[model samples]
Target: MRILIVEDNALLAQGLSAMLEALGNEVLGVAGDAESFVTAVLADRPDVAVVDVRLPPSFTDEGVRAALHARELLPGLPVLVLSQYVEDTYARELIADGTGVGYLLKDRVARVDDFLDALHRVAAGGTALDPEVVRQLLATRSDPLTRLSRLSRLTEREREVLALMAQGYGNVEIADRLVVTERAVHKHVGNIFLKLDLPPEDSGDRRVLAVLTHLGAPRRTARDGRDGRG
Candidate 1:
């Protein structure tokens, strides 16, 4: 894939460009500031772009601003924003785009293979977020998370199953990921719908929304590996 690198830190940007290049992809242009970031993306229209969470000038959310702008400028262009921290609002804003997007901590980049895998997946139209980031999101006092907590209480396995579902895994995909049977995945998903009190018409796309909303701010109902339920 031809990709752009939008990051303010010079050394980090150079390092990321080198690594991405080693993976057999072109790094079209590396921009160290917000204006240049936007310009490079609009000019090149690469397959995917890796952006920092913060950029020049403010360095607070310039990358976030660039990502939002790319949504309008490039439309379907896939983007992966790496950050040093999981700012709740930043995650919320990125997730709003719904697909072909990834928000992960900079630390995850150290896991080179997984990081590249995430890039490839996102470029191929997938959602990618760190597990701990998801965990942190679900732990907040958001309305959706609260409801998911109530929904989570209804079953033993459903809560465990919900995360994989939100991560864009299908029955077979989730089965392999969780080391479970396909039939078991189906049964757990069915129970999830019933327990969550989904609408009668909730199937397919609607089901995806339910899981997304639930996981968007999912509340954890377990302590460690133990379920909260008796």
Candidate 2:
């Protein structure tokens, strides 16, 4: 995958670039601030962008703004955002963009193999999120789907599969981890989607859609320059 990095910290950016290159992905360039990030997007247009949540000048959320703008210019462009902090609002907004997205903590990069796996998944038009982000979304009680009557429709095993799906595990991975047949996992996934009244997509990589179901609302957009406040 060809990746463009948007981060202000020089050491971290260099380390990430080196790590990604070592993992066999090409690092197209690094942008320290939002302006350069947008410039790189318009000019170079790498296959994926790995961005920091906070960036130069104001350092509030310039990186995400730049990423959103890049997506505006190039809709559905892949982005994997890394943050030192877990901002639920940021996660929700990014996921609202639909697919080919990831939001992970900076600490996750230390787990090099897993981080590379997630980056590749995002670049290949899939979805990934930090485990904590999944937890936060799952814990949102406002979701009408979480009501006992609706949730009671799922068997315990199916619920387990739903949780794993929210964690960005593909059916094959879920099957391997649960020691079940891939066919069984697929059946459970279909059942879960059906019980939740979600329309089935043939690809089944709709991790963002699954998360939105947990949130019990349609995808939301943040206002100009403001990720919805926590």
Candidate 3:
């Protein structure tokens, strides 16, 4: 993957660049602030952007703004937003943009494997959320989405697919992971969404938004499909 780091912390940026590069992915540029980050986005055109939730000047949502702008400017350019501090507003906004985006805590970086895994998933047009952020979204749960999220009377394999979709995996990759044909994966995905009571909208990677919103709702039982196990 071709990755860009839009972070102000010099040490963290360099460390991330080194690690991703070591993982055999291209490290395009590491920017110090929002302007430079936007510049890097235009110049490098990375397949994915790993951004800090805060940047210099205000140390507020500059990175989030840049991420949203980048998504608008470069369609299908997935972004992974990270922060040392916990926040849900940004995560909600990100999900509101649709899927192929990730919001993770900086502490997650300590778990390099998990962090990279999330990065790959995001780049491939999947969604990844910090557990805390998920909890926060759950607090504002919508009745419709919440009700639908409970409809998955999924088999273990179906649940695997559903969890992966919530994580932003495409059918092809999901099929490969489960050692099934992409065609079969597609059928399973369709079934999962149908069971969830979601209207077919874009029917693209943006589908992750619906999935995230559902998963973040109150947990739902797989069997009952009427009670709240997710």
Candidate 4:
């Protein structure tokens, strides 16, 4: 995969570039600021963009704004945003489109395999959100009644499945984590879709929709039922 990186930290950018190249992916170039980032995007049109949440000038949300603009210029452009901390608003905005996007903490890059997996997933037009980001989204609710209304139909097990889904885990991975059969995980996923009123559609991703629904609702801890049949 061809990748463009946007990060102001020189050493971190160099390290990331080296890591990606070592893995056989083409590192187009690293941009130090939002302007250069956008310029590189227009020039290279890379398979995926690995961006930092903070960049030069303002160091607030320049990377986020640049990423959003890049997508505007090239719709469906894949982006994997790296942040030092979980920024709730930035994460929500990036995943709002529900395709070819990822938001992860900078600390996650230490686990090279997982970081690469997330990059590849985003490049293939799949969501790869940080578990912490998922938790924050689930926990941030404006209206308690609205949250209850949305997720009231979900069983405790279904909520557990949905939470894992929001963290971008596949059915097989979720099954392994939950100590359930793959078939059982599939059933739980289906039930989640049904309860959330997310039907199978030829267009749009139901998994992403389910995750979004899970994020919209208030956080609910699932009962310990991993030993029971899923």
Q: Which is the leading candidate under lDDT?
A: 4
Q: Please give the lDDT score for candidate 4.
A: 0.80
Runs in model 1 with CA error above 4 Å?
154-156, 198-210, 214-230
Q: Taking the tens digit of each residue's C-alpha lDDT, what string does model 4 give over 1-230?
A: 99999988999999999989998989999999999999999999999999999998989999998997888787778999999998888887777644788999999999988898889988988878888888788777556676677688888888888777876778888899999998998888778777667664312234664457555622212242111110
Runs of candidate 3 with Cα error greater than 4 angstroms are 142-165, 169-197, 200-207, 213-230
lDDT of 1 by residue, 176-227 (tens): 8879898998888887777666543324323544555554533223442223
The estimated TM-scores of all candidates read 0.82, 0.85, 0.70, 0.86
lDDT of 2 at 15: 96
Relative to the unseen true structure, what is the C-alpha lDDT of residue 192 in candidate 3, on a scale of 0 to 100? Answer: 74
As for candidate 4, its clashing pairs are: none
Per-candidate Cα lDDT values, in order, are 0.73, 0.78, 0.75, 0.80
The better-scoring model by lDDT among 1 and 2 is 2
Q: State the lDDT at 193 in candidate 4.
A: 75
Residue pairs of candidate 3 with colliding backbone atoms: 126-168, 127-168, 219-229, 220-229, 220-230, 221-229
* Prediction 1 global C-alpha lDDT: 0.73
Better of 2 and 3 by lDDT: 2
